[model samples]
Target: MSKFILNKILPLFFLAFILLCFNCDGRDSIKKNHTQVLEENNLIQEFSEQVTYIPETNLETVTDTLLSSGYKIHIKTYFNMDSSVLKTRHQDSLNLKSYYRNGLADVIISTDDNVLFSKTITKTFIRENLSKPIEGLKSFILKSIWIDENTALNGTVIAIQMEYCIPETQDCLTFKLSVKTSGEYQLKQL
Candidate 1:
């Protein structure tokens, strides 16, 4: 009788051990899944925070009309190549100029002979030296302009430029300016 009881008790203990292992495995899997979900949520939140929001506008016609109306316009310059230093020659030349505020190029917006807005941006020519090929450069300014505001109508303009210097050369490259306008105007979406 004692031998029979021992056999039954041993089998019951084995079964309990197997069930405990399975339960532990299931709990581990759940914890892993939970951790992955939390990490994904954090990444999404971080990405959303990095996003910038811009208001919509329709302003192509208005900008064209403004341009045709003889409003002095200029675009910010950008360096197409890769570099961050400025050539000495270009820096000296810009320093001698006085028309633009702070001796920098400016985009001028005016109406009826009154200056509406002007954005001045300092640009660097990326070059190893004054005679070297341009690699790229950096700009220190960014500006957004509002062109018009009326009932059921609004407009905005954006302009940006950047420059850089090549290594071991004096030559520099200047990037073309980028300009955008939006509002009741019919501007192309970028």
Candidate 2:
């Protein structure tokens, strides 16, 4: 009688244990699904699409292509622009406007893979085709209120503040360009 009871009760307990194990929480799958949703929604893109920078030197042994020697200046730009929703009656007008806003700019100067200087500029705006129809809206403009440049001897360091406007019209936007250091190798800036 005892053996019969043991066989029946043991199987019931074993089945309950198996069910519990199968129902246990598995968070790994949940996290993976969340990431997939973000990618599908265009909330996060691959690194190449968002990161841009100038390399110090480019040496292609196979193609024999070479870049000039100098400190490589890397500029990474991030902007929140919803270009998908832009609509205009004129097809050409749609092509002329830039929807760049809330820009974040990162600048890094490096040589031989060693970082020499780094700076970040935020709260910048980029607009294209800001002119009137008569004047022809054919320009790309960057505007930033916070801008300055430092100079060094034997090197040209210039930070220019530019806002080109039609003197007859008040249509204008701000821009900043800097060449912190210019030499045989560090002559390029953006």
Candidate 3:
């Protein structure tokens, strides 16, 4: 009701969520049909954190959240991919390849009716952490987002971690973002 439900602030993760959907061809796939479609469109992948598939739209919402130190942290992600990239089951018949992947991450930090932080971070957020900028128009996956209480070891109010992946070469990088109660945050390449 607060608007963030679908399009408002309540929206965008994985510390980890393995999607296992029917592959139409009788094989099992880690990605749902709708997820594949969104990636192909090179658009924002729509879905909720729910792992269940919606036959009608093949989408749910892809988001993760946690309550910590009086602040609520929500991490939402949208996957992106290049249409040219073709996906095929590996010999294992499970893992995906060429599987171009990219994503948009929305991190929302709030308390009660007041919002302290909201950011839609892209690969750029972890740019400095990458060995080199991936060249050409390719796909990247906002692999995962999670709350890391271990950050308490660092004395921060809250710590969030996100992983960016490039399925083409099976490369992924995890980055950590921490915010103070004041709503300030910085991305650190973990």
lDDT of 3: 0.57
lDDT of each: 0.36, 0.39, 0.57
lDDT: the better of candidates 2 and 3: 3
Prediction 2 global C-alpha lDDT: 0.39
**Model 3 CA lDDT for position 128:** 47
- For model 1, the stretches where C-alpha displacement exceeds 4 angstroms are 1-67, 74-103, 113-117, 123-171, 181-190
Give, for candidate 3, the lowest lDDT window spanning 10 residues.
Answer: 49-58
Give a tens-digit lDDT track for model 1, residues 1-190. Answer: 8887789987898999999887876554565654365565685334222221111221121222254444444434332222222322224213221111112334555555565445554443212223444223332221222333231122244332333223334433334333334211112212
Query: TM-scores, in order shown?
Result: 0.22, 0.27, 0.49
Question: Between prediction 1 and prediction 2, which has the larger TM-score?
Answer: 2
For this target, which candidate reaches the highest lDDT against the unseen true structure?
3
TM-score of 1: 0.22
lDDT of 3 at 118: 86
